[model samples]
Target: MVTALMELKSLRKAYGETLVELGSENKNIVVLDADVSSSTQTKMFAQKFPNRFFNSGIAEQDMITTAAGLASQGKIPFVSTFAMFATGRTYDQIRNSICYSKFNVKIVATHGGVTVGEDGASHQALEDIALMRNLPNMTVIVPADYNECRQAIKYAVENERPMYIRIPRINLPDIFDNSYKFTLTAKVVEKGDDISIISNGDTLIESIKAGQMLKQKGISAQIIHCPVVKPIDKNILKLISNCKNKMLFTVENHSIVGGLGSAISELITDEGLGLKLVRIGVNDQFGQSGTAEELLDYYGISAIKISEKVIYEMKTTIL
Candidate 1:
């Protein structure tokens, strides 16, 4: 295992920097934020391209409809706000105005999942993935780290489509470098024969640590980082099918239902892969006010908890 300490970087910060760069390169690029520019870090874009940036002031639905209007004028509008408001509050506008018209609007929502910390359940967006993925013509992505987030944003800007990218509030360890290329397909981070561990977003780092812990116990885990949740990657089918033990695990920062785990489960069921899946996430419960670290451990999605769950499943299945 590589023991080097990786640099920590914030996905929101990466998004802000990348937005500024993309805005400078493309005159058609415009940004819209629903009141929380500072929190979502779209204030950076607002500062750089003041003329092109719009603040809708807490009306997420209005923000979505306005973005659609911009798209109709041939401008690529990137919208930003908290994940809870971005998806849940603006679902109707997003579905009707954006997706129905096939508008070229990108929704990059930050502070996803319980990692929003002290903000509590009302602010946390545990169901945003489920809500966004169900909408027709919507491309959903939850980037794992800083570099991936940067690349994903660039990809969204280049590709004219209705895309939703979820950014976590916390700083994560750098998982990829400058040369790393972002694609819609899932990337296999580690190869193993004993079990397959699929994850994305903040839980990805925890999954990696679990893989290391499992290795010490003689368990070879195949760790797959799946950043794109919607338009479920066809390549993942083959990767999971190739797992020797047919034991699959999906870890995510969202709910077990309608999140990455549910997506993978649906794939397995549809294909009749007959793989046993153990989803690691919030078990249909609302989050409480706590530190991100505390919430992760309490929810049993931490590295130690993930490893323990995998080991327990392996033993129980063997017996």
Candidate 2:
């Protein structure tokens, strides 16, 4: 059954609020922002915990390195910045300084994917997931909505390792409740006999709607939300993969190349699942300035387009 109606929420707020709560509980917790605290919502933590919040002032590399230093001192640092700056800008620092040493740091990268909208390509961190996950010690998470985002913050605080959490600039719907907990696996939101619509991040809202649309056309679509993108539950992949009839579709607000799509594709191919797969996301292209809704549709990653792709595939290939 549908868990909740699409309730729009500023995920950035959740990021900040959750940090404040965690900050109060754990004195070892410190926040670092690369001067985009307001946009990324680290400002909330800054307001609550003035002494603990450090603004790195537009220096992502310096910020990450500082976080590394803090981690080495037994401080669990939660770094916040735009996704592009957090990953693409500070990769060397993260790899050499943080991931290399397995620092206890959590990088909360907001404005990930095309959701940055009017900011265009340079601001959109489409390849962040692939980049972060490739690191040996990084735990990558892409929360689907508000509840997941809050829980992910909690998860990051409880765990001790180099972690990356990707959130959005836009307000997304609520997928889970206060009771929902995140694990390193996929959550099967809906079950079906035909196909699985595996997706993560804010794009999951569209996938759920797409599932309903597919049902109207007599498609029994299974909906799966992946909170933990890396360290994917291989058993879940095995459960839904390798079926000729139950093809797989990966939906993400990221590049079809190295993001979720590529991860699953590699899994299916390497394991010899031999299942038909289609990726719905940015088609190896840069983002353009526009509203989030417009960009999503233009890139053919919207709910309507996702369902259409499945319909077309079922007609031309499945049959």
Candidate 3:
């Protein structure tokens, strides 16, 4: 992992400031919200740059179409909304208007996966990655923490396309404390020889902790944190495929079908690797009402579960 040179902060706050920073330079940049400016923390951008911000109320579908229209006019519109509404409610708008035309519209979806707790299954978006990945010309990125989110936002602003950036609601750890640097691709955090635990988004912190625990048990576990999911880091995939470790585990906050686990599975298998692979993520089920911590534990996305999976795979395959 490249050392981050920027200060760390909350994910929401970081996103708010990033919009302002990027908006200051690019006059074409516009922020469009779907009655979630306060919840997604894009209100600050609206307040600072009133002329460039558009509040589309609760109509996610209209907001998407409006953003696409703005993009067609050479305006770089960033549509902000909850993950569920952005992907579920406005899927058609995204696929037809923005992506089909290949407009440079950025979708910044907050409250991704089970992290938007206390709001229940309705608020949580556990299938956004899976859903967004299928769209042509869509670049899916899940920032690991607040710092990475900030960097990801900066990168998106500079390199515009049909990009979907996913962020969590919880105040996660500052994995990059003014010492980590981020590329627009994958980041290899910790190295090991026993197994490789590849993950993305908020779940990466747990994967890192799992690596620490595995070290204590004398089982080397490599940790890879990839923020960009859609066009995955092919170099990292090639590296992992050639590992002496025969076991690979993927972790994610979303469902296993179309999330990071599936992304890794496709790459690993296509490379003809015989690694014993296992995926740790939310199953094909909707989450219930609970705290972020509760949902993580209930869905087996916690550090303990990751460690258990790694240990089990090692034991079962080593024989």
Candidate 4:
């Protein structure tokens, strides 16, 4: 960990900045948005390159189809909107027009999970990752902070495939520095042999705090930052499974079912690791209108909640 707490910055702003930079150099890179450009921060890209920017006027389905058309024309289309509308509302379009066709359409969805804050259940996207990962040709990614968000955006543009990148509405702390390399593989933020804490996206921030608290409580909790959910880092996971304590815990801002927890569960079970998994997430419930902090706590994704669960699990598993 760094000597001090990292500064808070918008992940969507990081996406907007990287999109502008990618657009300036590549004429074939086009952006599409469903009238939430300001909120999603894609307005920065639109202003920089008006000719290449397409506005679908609140129709997320139409945006998906439009991006698919652009992708068919050999252009890399980055579709932008809220995660709920972009995924759940336009699932059919994305699955058929984008993923089925294997087009180079990169969906950059903002306001994922309960962090949409005060928007209520209908707006929060607790199942976007599940939806995207189910598609055949879609690459699912949830960048933890600004640095990874920028790198993921750049990587999505360069790599030709249908992809979904989820970003939160609230500001996130910088986890990696300028020198840190971004890879599709899972990264171990802190190495500990006692236990493993797997996490991704904004929730990783809380998981990191949970690890620090667990450390003070005499638990050597290993922190694993899983940026890519679909193509999981199996090698790293296999290595971590044989570490000090054979306990694995996954924390996510999404629902426990069909999310990171489910993915890790399937991995351990399939590989016959015989490891126990403690999944910390929204336990199959709808989100509610509240401040981001309140929602996280209510949904059992807060730092304190995560730390408590760690202690509780350690005791039960040990006994």
Q: Rate residue 82 of model 4 by lDDT.
A: 92
lDDT for each residue of candidate 1 in 1-319, tens digit (9 for 90 to 100) = 2223577789999999999999999999999998999988999999999999999997889999999999999999999999999999999999999999999999999999999999999999999999999999999999988889999999998888999999999999887777778899998888887889999999999999999999999999988999999989978988876667878899988899899999999998898876799999999999999999999988989899999999999989852
lDDT of candidates 1 onward, in order: 0.92, 0.87, 0.85, 0.89
Candidate 3, 4-92: lDDT as tens digits: 33343468778998899888988999999999899888999999999999999989999999999999999999889999999999999
C-alpha RMSD in Å of predicted model 3 compared with the true structure: 2.2
Over 12-53, each residue of candidate 2 has an lDDT whose tens digit, in order, gives 888889998888989999999988888888888899999999
Candidate 4 lDDT score relative to the true structure: 0.89
Model 4 / residue 30 / CA error / Å: 0.6
Tens-digit lDDT track for model 4 on 186-257?
888877778899999999999989888988999888889888888877876665765677788999999998
The residue ranges of model 3 lying beyond 4 angstroms of the native Cα positions read 1-8, 179-181
Q: Which wins on TM-score, candidate 2 or candidate 3?
A: 2
Listed in order, each prediction's TM-score against the native is 0.97, 0.97, 0.95, 0.97
Error of 1 at 254 (Å): 0.5
> Which ranges in model 4 have alpha carbons more than 4 Å from their true place?
1-5
Per-model RMSD to reference: 1.5, 1.4, 2.2, 1.3
Q: Cα deviation of 231 in candidate 4 (Å)? A: 1.2
| Ranking of candidates on lDDT, top first | 1, 4, 2, 3
Please list all clashing residue pairs in model 3, or write none if there are none. Answer: 2-181, 3-179, 3-180, 3-181, 4-179, 4-180, 4-181
